[model samples]
Target: MLDWLRFGLGTLLMLGGLFVLVTAVLGQFRFRSALNRIHAAALVDTLGILLMLGGLILLAGWSVVSLKLVLVIAFLWLTSPVSSHLLGKLAVTLTDHPEREMQVDDPSLTRDVKEGD
Candidate 1:
């Protein structure tokens, strides 16, 4: 009975992750702005990987494999947001008008972005 419950929970988590990833992919195409696309990519990197890995960990049942999965999740959690922020910054930097892609609260950034910095 416990085994069945574990399997079911794992499957559900994996499915939810897959669904999040698929929607993010769709959002990438739907959004015209690079910043929007980056947001979608971030969602895939974070929530999608997290859910799928969590399910894998549950399925692995506290083994060495599960520990490795947890490590992978931790590594990704540390790296994904930084990468996403960099990508968004690059998008804003490269665009002719960063204000169009995203709001520049800092006057310094607004000036730099307008100048294509």
Candidate 2:
């Protein structure tokens, strides 16, 4: 029946999402630098949420809960990147030696900083 088919597909999606989420968490611990951790988390945040919620919506059918899930996914997709960018900027600004971690391919992009400026 249609119900059984929906259940199977929804479960598969949910499981896949759970796997991605767990991997991201482990990646955070595996990566040492702040920028690397942010990269790990931000990379999977949207994809994991989308997969899990998309599965839930499918199982819930055409209902109000499904609509809310869609909205939540949209909100997260918008915010996750902004937050990640801010965190990355903070890491770059605070680090005493940004050069070791970051590379600027263009010499024109940066200005020389005097020893006492």
Best by lDDT: 1
lDDT of all predictions, in order shown?
A: 0.86, 0.83
- Estimate candidate 1's alpha-carbon lDDT, on a 0 to 1 scale: 0.86
Per-residue lDDT over 54-105 for candidate 2, one digit per residue giving the tens place of the 0 to 100 score: 9999899989999999999999999988999888777755666656665756
Question: In candidate 2, how many Å is residue 94 off?
Answer: 0.8
Candidate 2 residue 39 Cα shift, in angstroms, is: 0.6
Give the lowest summed-lDDT range of ten residues in model 2: 108-117
In candidate 1, position 8 carries an lDDT of: 98
Q: After superposition, how far is residue 7 of candidate 2 from its true place, in Å?
A: 0.6
